[model samples]
Target: MKVRIGVGHVPVGAHDPAAGLAELADELEAHRVDSVWLSDLASAPHTVDPLIGLAYIAGRTRRLKLGTGVLILPGRDPAVVAMQLAGLAALAPGRVLPTFGIRPAQPADRPAYAVPPGRHAEVFEEALTVVRALLSRPNVTHHGEFFHLDEVSIAPLPAKPLDLWLSGRLPAALDRVGRLADGWLGSNITSGEAEACRVRIERAAADAGREIEPDHYGTYLTVVLDDADERAVGALLDGIRRRRPDGADPRTLVCRGWAAAREEMRRFVDAGLTKFVVRPAAPVTSRRDFLDQFVAELGPMET
Candidate 1:
């Protein structure tokens, strides 16, 4: 398997978004980091809208692949999303990597990602269908429970179709990925769990007569450096505790230092997961420092 590493949204606060993003793009490209990802957070203060941020980053850098660690897909208009992604893909060519999820990560933000009551999965699947149709064909027509379209198409499509990835851990979600998603991007799960999840997705894909690329599987790893302050460490633990499954230790899901993070990636590679988007568990004092340490530790690990 080809192991590739990408950066999740940098947690360090930037006084100037444009300059900061430009610097980030330059550094990541210089380091030859595989990609850069932005998480979706409609209500979070100072968080860049994933799509808009990616568009700006696309203009600032040539080699760094742009990704939405995951943008919430169910609520947005599929046609618009299709066009937006199409635009990004057209601009960046092979560098646009879009992964979507059905719901926002934070509970307080869920309401903003509105879907018809009791039909989230259905809506998500249909919305993806509409998006795929619009991205590839002209004068497309789609009529579904949550969306309706007629003779709608996005022009100047990507030279190659963009691979649509998805994130989810539940059985139903894995099934959905196998049936519909081009790949999977999991988070907050152990290597054992990730291995099992990959098997499940592949099985479901086989049952559905589909096959996800082996190297397309990836996950977001939250790492807390040894030098992280108490508040940062405590906040990471507390958030994970609240989100952890019953009886599961929150500590088991996080990497404690660069060494541990590297070891964890090796474990994941052994489990057949090849792509990674590693995010600092808490905000860093310096994005450049964190990235420098990140490359020193994990750069050689990529194959």
Candidate 2:
């Protein structure tokens, strides 16, 4: 398998976010990191809007692939989303990687991504359909329960069609990836779980009479430096616990050092994951220290 590694959005604590993001983008480009992913959190004050942040990064760097780790799709207008992606594709060409999710990450923020009651899944599917149509077709007429588009067209379409990737670990979500998406970028799951999910996706695609590309399975891996400060480690523990309250030990899920991270990456690669987004478990005091380590260690592992 061809392994491609990328950086996830690292929190810019106590720094000017605009400047921090610019510097981070520049450094990633300088170091030749494969890509940079922005998380989508609609209500979080600290989080940057993925599309806008990506556009900014696109301007700052020439070779970096820009991604929305998982943009929420049910609440947004698909046509508008398509237009934004088309613009980005026009600007960045083959570097726009969009992975969409059915809902926001947090329950409290779910209301902010408002869709019809009990119809979030349906709305997401419909919205994706509309977005795909608008991106690839010159004139699209889609009539669904949630969306109605008549002879709509988005100009400046991508030179090549954008590959629509999806996120989620549930069985239904895995099946949907086979039926609709061109790739999968899952999160917060073990290598064993990811392997199983990949199997389901392949089975679904076969049943759908469609074939997904072999090298499109990817996942996020959060890691911490072994010598990281106590506060940083504590924050990382708390964040993972809150995000996953299902009693899984944080140590089992998070890599404690560079060696551990490499071993985990190897396991994931053996399990059929060819793409990775490695995020810091917590905010670091020195971007250079973290990035330098990233380059010295995981960077060489890229195929």
Candidate 3:
């Protein structure tokens, strides 16, 4: 299987988002990196609107694929997102990969969507259907519990298909991915866990008379390169708290250093996962320095 790596766009502090992304898009291509990704966080200060940032990156560079770790797909108009993605696809056809996620029942974030927390599942499914339909054709007429459209359409169909991927480790989410999404983009789970879940997904796909591409399984790994694991863990705890399953600490999920991170990728490769999006937890103090370290150390390792 072929291996591909994508760098995640995560700002640390006091940085120009555009400059940072432009530099990253260039460096990623220079390093032979396969793709670049952005994290969508409306509440977090370190994140940016991935749709906008990724589009900017797409315009700045050629041959570098763009992606999102997980774009929240709830509590918004599916038509707006459909139009935006269609526009982005027009700019960068096969190069764009947008993964959708139905966010959890967070009180602060839930209110903005207006849909009850309990109904997120149904709404997410319907919205995804609408977005898929809108992206594939010039016009779509859809009627669902969350969205209603009358022959609405977007211009400039993508040169190639914009395959939608789903990210989540929960059982219901896994089943949803198998039944609906074109691929699975997961996080917060180990390689062994991913392997076991792949079986479940395959069964669900069979039940649904659908199939997921063999090499589409991937995970979003947050890597912390620091002097000590404790320091790294402390810095990342607040951000990944929700992702830390059971009683697992931040250290259990995040890579401790360069060697550990490479080894983890090898483990994932052994588990039959070939795609990865590695996000750095530390600040991008120097783009050149960060790219040098990331490319030299964390670039795809031979298995």
Candidate 4:
């Protein structure tokens, strides 16, 4: 399988969205990165909408593929998303890949965007099916538990079908990827965990009477880099600490030094992951530096 390398969104905690994205696009184009992705955080302050941000970047850069890391599917109506995506693809032909995922909505965000506690995955599947059909056909009518469309068609169709990816951490989600998604994207998972997840997805595909070829499996890793000693690295580590999972230490999850980080990526690649999206742990000042170091270490492998 071919290995693909991509740069993901810088955590929106401390950066100015417009300036940060502008700089990021320039850096990615300079390094010849494969694809550029942005995150969708429903309630985060200063976070740009992923689709709008990608459209802005699309106009600025020529060759880089644009994608959403994972758009929280349950947050918006599928028909609305389909229209938005179709329009974006019309503007940037064959360049946008829409990645969708099911996320547990926060308590504070529930009133604004509500899905029953256990029903997000089901809703996501139904929504994706509706959207995919509408994008492909001229006039489509569908009735599903979550969505209903009658003779709907998306105009200015894309040159090719969009590459759809699913992201999650549950076995059920892996099964959904096998049956519905064109690729899988994971977060904060170890290499061993990734391999196990891939196995489950392949098994689910087989069980569903689908053939599994070279699946596009991608993982996100937190990386910290400093030209000096660990103190500079520690600052970046602190940023990650703020976002650590409920019971885990941030230090345990980050790849610190350049050498160690490269080895960590190697392990994931060896485990059958064909793509990687690296999330830098540093602030804006250090983000470019870490990106440069990462490209120097990993770019040749992709080439």
lDDT of 2 by residue, 133-242 (tens): 89998999988899998899999878788899999888999999999999999887889988999999999999999988889999999887775666867766777677
CA RMSD of all predictions: 1.6, 1.5, 2.4, 3.2
Compute the lDDT of residue 168 as modeled in candidate 4: 78
Which candidate order results from sorting by lDDT in descending order?
2, 1, 3, 4
- Model 4, runs deviating above 4 Å: 11-13, 104-112, 227-252, 286-288
Write down the TM-score for model 4.
0.88
Error of 4 at 78 (Å): 0.5
> Which is better, 3 or 4, measured by TM-score?
3
TM-score per prediction, in order, is: 0.96, 0.95, 0.91, 0.88
Q: What is the lDDT of residue 148 in candidate 4?
A: 80
The local lDDT score (0 to 100) that residue 63 gets in candidate 2 is 95
In model 4, how large is the Cα lDDT of residue 83?
Answer: 86
TM-score, predicted candidate 2 vs. hidden true structure:
0.95
lDDT per residue as tens, model 3, 1-303? 677777787453454455567777777777767788786667555446789888888887878898877888888788899889889988887788999989832445545566765888998999999988988888899877778899897877776668999888888998998899888887877888888778778888989999888888888777776633454457567556755647666567778778888998888888878888887766655656666787888774632
Supply the global lDDT for candidate 1.
0.87
Please report, as a residue range, the 10-residue window in candidate 4 with the lowest summed lDDT. 104-113
